[model samples]
Target: MKTIRSRSDRWFDAVNNVLIAAVGLICLLPFLHVLAKSLSNQASVMGNKITFYPIGMHVEAFRFVFAHTRFFEALQVTLLVTVIGTVLSLTITILAAYPLSKPEFKGRKPILLLYVFSMLFYGGIIPGYILMKALGLLDTIWAMIVPLLVVPFNLFVCKTFFEGIPESIEESAKIDGATNFRILWSIVLPLSLPVIATLGIFYAVGYWNNYFHPLIYISSVDLKPLQLFLYETIANTEELLQEQPDSVRLSMAPEGFRAATVISSIVPILLVYPFLQRYFVTGMTLGSVKG
Candidate 1:
């Protein structure tokens, strides 16, 4: 037999469910409206004709966007940045974080204080630009890859997590005749998967969405990352349309095509997100729990 709730309890539960659904709709409606607008006729959109649903359907915005040569070139650059940047950042961050995680290692305290100090400040853009220029990294992909070799937040989290791990494991490995480098490589790396995966996703997303770096450092049109290309595509649509009178000008930029580009850029990350999502909570919690 089912037990009935009191009138007040039922009312509260009903209100709570309503609130949850309302919040979900608030989040969901915008994406749907964007999708609808992407498919809607330009005339309908320009006059503010559509509301929660599109007034009329159209698909030309995507066609127009894909027809350009620059989109593909920018896409290739973005892929390179996301893949290579993620790997390089992971390598540097993990290598730096691992040593800092261990306290018994000599000079770890000073090195950590140095990392903490770095988090607070940076040489302004002019000096940074001069250094990069002196190094001949300007307009080169290396400018994007080399500048962000260390991440302070990742280092701290990793350090805290490593501190939580007992020193006895390394001691055991050493007692078994394993060298310092060997124990770190063979045991610590394997045990550190959760944090590594977590940081990998974080760095990957940062690289994928990075635009300012491309704007400041890269001079060649070919070197523009996907976000920069997408920004230019959205921001300069009118000028582009002006240059080619007969070519189509998408009024709403076909919410579909814009959404499609966004979705595409994110899909790679999404594919990897599930695997790491499990580790994310645990990895992130390590710092909080240890502290």
Candidate 2:
């Protein structure tokens, strides 16, 4: 039997499509503007003539940013922290989540409550900074990685996915004389790639974009991440310009410089997304679905 769509159904579909397109454009337009401004000639950028496309196209801003030694150092620091932190965070989250997913585990509920409580009630930045200072993590890369080893929300997402796994699979592994650790390593983890990829990206993106923790804990210029560098670049542009000779400052485009720096900082992680794109939707669905 052929099913006929109702008029109201068609109207609702049209409205939903329009709203989704609108939302996408809202998010996309700002990035387009930044890209256009970055690529545009200094005069066009300064005159605010650049919009979604480059006006009097030029790559001078990109050239200047790439040549900057400080920018490269910050980029290296950010890449290091993001990779190391994401790996550590995922490892810890998996260790904790797997145990909590098992209903037979004693005190699981209490442990879960503690994790949830920490998420809801965190000590403010001052306390966190003081703790980092006391631990001698201040002004170090460890300060960026250690303080955010695990996120409770991500832990719960992994736990939910684990809980959904059929017990029969583990039982079969047990019959084969597999230990708990062996089961987790060889069996459970192999089956949980979707959630792993999802959480990995989540952790990676968080560490990559982190500026607040860096701002508070890291005082050393050498330890600053790309985000802090970008912030300082824009924030100090005017002061830097004032310090420069009038001819040099007049020739430079501060807005274009800032935009190019922003793009460069974000481009690496953005490139990484497409490789993990296939797993993302599946991971979110499986990890979030709770019975």
Candidate 3:
């Protein structure tokens, strides 16, 4: 059977499409402009002539950034924290989420309420700093990973998704003499790939872009993450440029450096997202559906 749309329906569809396209351009144009600025020559960048495309193509900014020792060190730090933090966060979230998803678990409500409560409130920065100091975690890489190990909202999302899985699968595994660990390892994880990939992206992005925690806890120049390094570099560019010998400063494009730094920091997540986008969409749909 085929149904035909009325003129009014067609009009509404046209309007919706226009609005969605406008919204997408709004989100996309800024990145394009930044990319243009990053790649454009210093003269055009400083003149603000580059918009969505490079006016005079150049790669000097990228070369300068790649050659900088501080940038390389900070990039390494960000990668380490992102990889290690995402793995730890996923493992801990899964362990906690699986147990909480079980209806027969005693104190589940209380435990869940505790998680919800944490989500609603936080000890302010002073207390968090004090606690980090007490634990001797400040100024170290663990300082980046430990404080944000498990996000409560993500935990609940995973738990809710886990609960949506049919109990019969677990029962069948049990009947086959599979231990709970075995069932979770072999049966549950394979089926939960969508959610796991989604959560991994979430955790990776969070850790990758985190600057506030690093700003507060890290003091060593060598220990700062890429985001923090970028922040400091941008903020102190004038002072640093003034200190540089005239020949070096004359060649460096501050605006191009800034744009390149922004691109470098964001490009990793942009690269990773497209690959996981299908799983991300599927996971969100399944996780949102009430079982």
Candidate 4:
């Protein structure tokens, strides 16, 4: 059987499509403008002639940024933190969530309540810094990695997904003489790829874009991440321009340099999304369905 739409339904569909397209354009246009500025010649960029398209296009800004040694150092630091932090966070989240998902686990409610409570409250920046200092983590990469290993939200999502898995599979594995670790490693995790990828990207993005923790705990220039480096670059562009040779300054505008750095910093993370896009929606949907 086929159902026909009324005139009002057609009107509503048209309006919804228009609104969604408008919102998409709003998010996309600003990025296009930045990309234009990065590629536009210094004269066009300074004169505000660039918009969604480049005017008198050139790649000098990218060239200048690529030649910067400090940028590479900061990139190295951010990469290290993002990779290590994501792996450790996913490992801890899975470990903690697995036990909590099982009803037979003792004291599960109280432990879960503690996690939720901590999520809703914080000890403030001063105490966090003091704790990092006391632990000898200040000025080290561990300061960034250790403090954020377990996000309550991710833990809950993993727990919900684990609970959705059929108990029959685990029981079958046990019948084959498999231990708990073997069941999780060989049976459960293999079936939980969607949720794992989802949480993996979440942890990766948080660590990559994290700025406040590094600002508080890291005092050494060598340990600064890409976001902090970009901040300092934008904040001190005038001083940087003065330091550069006259010929170099003439070839690149301050705004162009900033735009180039912004694009460069984000492109790597953006590249990661497409590969995981297939699993993202499925993971979030299935993970939330049970709870």
Tens digit per residue, CA lDDT, model 3, 1-291: 899999999999999999999999999999999899889988898888988998778877777667753888998999999999999999999999998999999999999999988999998999999999999999999999998899997888889889999999999999999998999999889988878988888898889889899999999999999999989988877776677677656765788878887887778778878887886677566577647
TM-score to true structure, per model: 0.83, 0.92, 0.92, 0.94
Error of 2 at 199 (Å): 0.6
lDDT of 2 by residue, 165-229 (tens): 89999999999999999999999999988789889988988899899899988888999999999
Task: Itemize residue pairs with steric clashes in candidate 2.
Answer: none
User: How many residue pairs clash (N, CA or C atoms closer than 3 angstroms) in each of the candidate models, in the order given?
Assistant: 2, 0, 0, 0
How should the candidates be ordered by TM-score, best one leading? 4, 3, 2, 1
lDDT of 1 at 68: 51
lDDT per residue (tens digit) for residues 159-201 in model 4: 9999999999999999999999999899999999889988998
Residues 176-273 of candidate 1 have per-residue lDDT tens digits of: 99987898789888887777777777787778778877789998998988888877766766676656536455443434456445544545566877
The Cα local distance difference test for each model comes to 0.74, 0.88, 0.87, 0.90
State the lDDT at 183 in candidate 1: 86
lDDT of 2: 0.88
Query: Can you list the residue pairs that collide in candidate 1?
Result: 38-255, 39-58
Among all windows of ten consecutive residues in candidate 3, which has the lowest summed lDDT?
Answer: 281-290
Model 4 stretches with alpha carbons more than 4 Å out: 1-4
Worst window of 10 by summed lDDT in candidate 2: 240-249
Q: Arrange candidates, best lDDT first.
A: 4, 2, 3, 1
lDDT, candidate 4, at 175: 95
How many times do residue backbones clash in model 2?
0
Task: Show where candidate 1 strays beyond 4 Å.
Answer: 1-24, 245-247, 250-283
